[model samples]
Target chain A: MKPLHISAYTTVSALGRGNAAMLEALRAGKSGLQPLHFPPAELKTYVGFVEGLEHEPLPEELAAFECRNNRLARLALRQDDFEQQVAALRERHGASRVAVLIGTSTSGILNTELAFRRRNEAGELPVEFDFVHSHQLSSLVDFVRRLLQLQGPGFTVSTACSSSAKVFADAWRLMAAGLCDAAVVGGVDSLCLTTLYGFNSLELVSAEPCRPADSQRNGISIGEAAGFAILEREPVEGSRGQLLGFGESSDAYHMSTPHPDGLGAVEAMQAALARAGLASSDIDYINLHGTATPSNDRSEDRAITTVFGTNTPCSSTKGWTGHTLGAAGITEAIIAMQCIEHGLMPASLNTRQLDPDFGSTILLEQRETTVNRVLSNSFGFGGSNCSLIFGGRNDHPLP
Target chain B: MTTLYLDNLGVVAPGLSDWPGAAKVLRGEADHLAEPLKLTAPELLPATERRRSSDSTRLALRAAEQALSLEAAQRLQPAAVFSSAYGDPTITHKLCELLSGTPPMASPTLFHNSVHNAPAGYWSIATANPMTTTSIAAGDESFATGLLYAAAQVVAEQRPVLLISYDLPYPKPLSEKCEVSAPFASALLLSHQASAQSIAQLSLSLDKGPETIMDLPLESLRRGNPAARALPLLAILASASGECLLPYLAEQRLHITVTPCR
Candidate 1:
């Protein structure tokens, strides 16, 4: 397998607008979670909602595709130096050699939902409700491609929470196979009624923000975010970050639950370590996919313990950023990259006391450490799981 | 490069329930297009667990069972790649409906099935395979994506992979979203070696030409009956000569150069 370079990246989450804001928030231990209030209902809960985005106006051409989810995507794409990074990549590699691969569980279905509401009320969908713009599974990827004028292979992966994490694998394959020189891989999932209500119905949404790994940990707090990373086949000196390895596995267990023994999760973590050619002790910190759901946290804790034991520091960023669903993988991946770059590990916020059942080492506060290698996990519904290993440019020797 | 062979193939589409039945229909030996069966949770699922499955889950399980027989089903472990275009639209629509309502409440079952990988999960549970699996969705190109992923997995992991691609007709609100109609499912058991007597080697390449292939109808090719496209390649391969270009989308062409070695 060939290595894929992380040329440049940017993210838009509840923490704020770009990489700088996110890094600053992580450093200051600022929580992006806040109470959310929406029309047609009243539910009191904390959400990692991106502020000021609700009123962000879309351009006339992109207005027809307006929805909560796509709005977040547009806002993320319009962030500081984000468009420039994409343009620079396009210039380095021809547009056709650059691909767009985004992961989003809800794509533009939020818009479709609104259109359906209107249809049900008026007995027909409005003419302006373009199905192509509303429900195409590739809508977000297509939107990004059109925005950046990319002609390469555009795709969207929707494998639940691991959606964005698997994008790294896809980009790696494309680059290794010489299909594309560079690719944009990440995810975007915004807070919509469907996701909130759905998780609530599953009894997985926490009344308050979550406390991952805490004995009293209840459920997850949903969030919205859009994060993108530009990946290349080869690295340029002093340019950006690098992706080490990614491992994926499926547990044929129950739909909503993980394997009781955490076998699949353990296999995926080990596979990632093997691909990166690193040992268990080589990982300095782990960003766990701790949704704070009882089963998920315990299962993940077991998997982490099996691999890293209780020596390495690990924490679930979901405490601060909330569970971004499809976006959680990439959003947290970006956070891990930041940790590697800055030599600091963000604490798992809102978790006062660790759960006795969780036997793995966990970082409770923002700690200064010489971070070299970090592993991030994203486990989704249906046992779709992915683990990504990230290290600094000089952390490992060139292959 | 090592060549991968298609050892065995099975399909449960709108017109057939089994491979031989499908072949018969393709050969014009059968007239009636098999009535599309709506996979009910009760009929296609484990008797005790039927109430827990969604429509898409039922369809996926039924199609997988029809694709993998009792003998082959026993051989399957968790390592499979499931692909679909629109995954569980019924659940997706229900979620959307909840989002539109006051104090939204999404069904737990619906939420579980909404994941694109739900089919893979169901198949793994049914087959008791604990191996690694990947689920992919690539619009109309889902089948090709599955084939590519399966081939890559076989080459990378050195394991025989089961590739299942399925999609059910979208419900009313979602039907307005995409232009697909009628439910269909297709499965292929691919291996690095020729495991059976009827093995076909598929070589795909991008070629420049005016779209349409000689003597091949564009309509039938677009209808997703790959056998129509496969027949020409089979004829050419059987004779040990010639190549067939199959149209993929409008701008792209899948130049399939087939060779038979038995």
Candidate 2:
């Protein structure tokens, strides 16, 4: 697979806006998770809630497409001059040649829940409720495309947790096939009652901040975030990083539970290495999906050991931002980019001690190390799994 | 532009049952009638899993079963692409109803089944396929986007691919906002090389202007359901060589030139 240059990228998570805030939080060993209060759910778990969304609504020109999910996307786009960079890409490659691919698990269903609450006596939804632009799964991509003024192919990928990570592969294939020369790929998932309660129903929501790979690890703290990146077939003067390869696979075992032996996870990791034409030792660090679930960390430990053998320094940023669900892919991908920019590998923030049964070397404190390549993992419901490998150009030669 | 070989097709809709039966109506050899859809769970799923599957999942699995049951495709493990404008509206409405309650009693089964890729997951489990599978949506242009991505996969990986586009009508209150009256699904097994069961060769390109329209009755079906937008191209495949445009992104249409191989 040919490498795609990441020209520009931005993220808005509980850690704050842009990569600087995230790096600062990582360096200070501070966690951004606070008590869950917004959306008014009945759950007692903590969450990665962003502040000031109510004060920042969509512009009047784009008022028709209004919702929490799109608002979060707009906030992230406003950061790092992402929209202007997209405009320059639109100008360089005619507007029709830049595709927009986004991911979202529940786009604006929060508004639909409100609509359901506001139903009339006759069971009729409110006349003002906009389902097409607000609640549809495609709304996230549509909103981004219209806001960025892109005109090429665009669609929404919704495979739960792996949604956003898979878009990088989609962008690569489209470019490889000559459909588009560049793409704007990212994901947006806002806090909603459905997801909040959905995780509770599955008993996967941790009552406290999640602790990855810890012996006492219980469950995940749900989070909301939006992250975007621009990928060009050719590199520009100051490209951020390179998407060397991505691998996608299905569990073929269970819908929600991963394969007991981590078969699918192993396949995804090896496939990514094969696609990148790199050996296992070439990777400098790994961003584990490490959602803090006992089953998740246990299974991922086995997979990592089978592939990298308990040697590569790895940690889960979920402790810092919690599990962003669909946004986890791009959120951690940007974090991996930051790891390359600054020679820093962060520790699993909430985990005080490593699990005795675990084989991998889980980081306990931040370490400053020379890094060139990073592998990020994102697994989701429906047995969907995707692993992405990103690297700088100094070590690996261009294909 | 890229060229792909369509090996087999599976279809399930209001009046159309399968590809063979629907071909006559699509070719104008028989009158199309509006009828309620009756779907059964695919036999491949375990009994318990089948009983727990949602209508959207069953609809997609049924179409994939029809397309892959052919001997030529039976042994080929192809990557899959699933698309739907509204995925499992029944499950969504159910979850919404549950979440609106005071305690919010969300069922675990319903929560996992609520994902857009639930159908893809079930299909992979039934077939035991470990290949890459993706679920996507693009408002009303879901089928076109699905087709484009499937073709791109064929060109990139040089392997057989299964593309499934399906949608079920939403329950009341929600239906009033996004009205899809009937259930519809279609599956296409595409590859870079023609096989013994190849039906047609399609060349896809982007174009501007109005898309191809259907007859009065089928036009309503096409307008009501996003997956039904593939009818124009399906009709061309059922008949002979022709070109038709399907709605794509906001300002562009997907122009497909079909060359019959049967």
Candidate 3:
């Protein structure tokens, strides 16, 4: 696999905007989960909802892409000077040479949720409710492409949770095939009623902040976030991260539940390591897809233990950002880069006790260590699974 | 952007149920229908899975089953890529109706099936294949995008790849706004190695030309559905002659050219 450098990255999550905020929260071992106040209420659960979304508005020219999902995407792009940086990239790569691939689960479905309530007596959707520009899954890619003024190949990936992580693989394939010289790969999923009530109905939402790997861990703390990464054929000056490899698989077990033994999860991890040409021992730390649910954590732990022998330091950042669903992939991948840059392993916050039934090393306290390669797992519903390997390049780029 | 072989094809559309039927329609042996086509459940999927399958899921799985069940596609678990422009609008409408009520009550069944990858999962489950499956959408350009992705995978991995592109009409509330009025799904089994049964060889490259859609007599039916955008490519595959260029990236307006094997 040709190593595609993650030249730049940004994330707007429950903690705050950009990578700095995520680092701050990680260092402080802060938990972002809070009681839910948004609509589609009555689910007594905690969520990692971003603040001030109501106060921010989309750029006037791009207002046609308005929705919670796009707003969050814009907010994320605004952070870490991502938009300006991409503008520079556009100048270098040429707009037509750059591609935009975005991943999203519920792309502006909240708008439809609201519009459904405003239906006329004849039960017709509102004329102003532009479904294609807003609620459609393609809207995220369309909005991002418009805002960035890109002309290269573009598409949207919507395979539940692993959607964004899989984008890294696509960018690799496209660039490797010389389809695009650079790509803007990322994901955005804003808080919406569908997930709020849907996960609740499935009895998968936890009432309190989730505790991954805890013996009594019950369910997940649903979260919303947006993240992006710039993948260039060459490494940018001072770039600390490169997409070394990625693996994707389908559990093929059930639609909603995970494989009891994490078979697909293991296969994905092994494939990522193989693609990266790294041994299992080469992994410095792992960002588990530990959504804090009993089934998810247990299954992920088994997979981790099988691959890394329960000695590799690993933790679930969901306690800090909650499970951001589609956004989890890039969000955590950025976190893995942070680990390589700062030499910090964020602990699995909120888990007071480890699940005795598991054998994986589930870190509970922040550890300051020399980090190199990091593996991040993101498994989605309907059996979509993706594992991404980032960082581990020892030599510094020309500065 | 690598040359690959199209080992086989499967497509379902109005007045067309299989490649033979589609070839006939393209050759004027059969008349293209104007009415929406009804989808049939795939017998390969178990009763329980099929019962839970929506029209979109059934349409997707049936096409793949048709292609993979053929002798040419010996490996049932070829890496799969599923594409849809309008994903399960029926399920989305149903969920909307439930959520629109005073107190929202979501059906767990519909919620699971609403994800764009639901159909992809059912394919793997029915075939007992746990390999990587990707579900993507490119609005009206899904067919071209899916083709590029599948071809790239075949070249990169040096293995046969299964590509399924499907789209179905939504209920009234969504249909009144969305352009799709008919349901369509098509499948292609591609590989780097040209087999004895190869239908045609395709060399894909980005075309910086105008977006070219297929010219079908059932204009309204073809234009309304996104999957029908593949008709021009399908017509060429069935013709066994000539070259074709189809629309791709929306803003780039890039086209993908497909040439038949001599």
Note each model's CA RMSD in angstroms. 3.4, 1.2, 2.2
Q: Any runs in candidate 1 off by more than 4 Å, and if so which?
A: A62-64, A120-122, A397-399, B1-3, B32-34, B40-46, B66-79, B193-198, B208-250
| Better TM-score candidate (2, 3) | 2
Q: Output per-candidate TM-scores for chain A, rounded to 2 decimals.
A: 0.96, 0.98, 0.97
Ranking of candidates on lDDT, top first: 2, 3, 1
**lDDT digits (tens) for residues B10-109 of candidate 3:** 8887777888878988877778765556676888777888778888889998888778883333354688999998789899999988888878778889
lDDT of each: 0.73, 0.91, 0.85
Score candidate 2 by DockQ.
0.85
- Which candidate tops TM-score? 2
Q: Rank order by DockQ, top first?
A: 2, 3, 1
| Docking class for candidate 3 | medium
Ranking by TM-score: 2, 3, 1
Residue A35 miss distance in model 3 (angstroms) = 0.4
What does the lDDT read for residue A40 in candidate 3?
Answer: 51
Superposed model 2: Cα runs more than 4 Å off:
A393-399, B70-74
Candidate 2 lDDT, tens digit per residue, B1-262? 8899999889999889899889999998988887898878986677878899999999998999889963333379899999999999999999989887876668899999999999999988888888889999998999999999999989988999999999889999788898997999999999999877788999999988899999989999999999999999989988878999999997689999999887
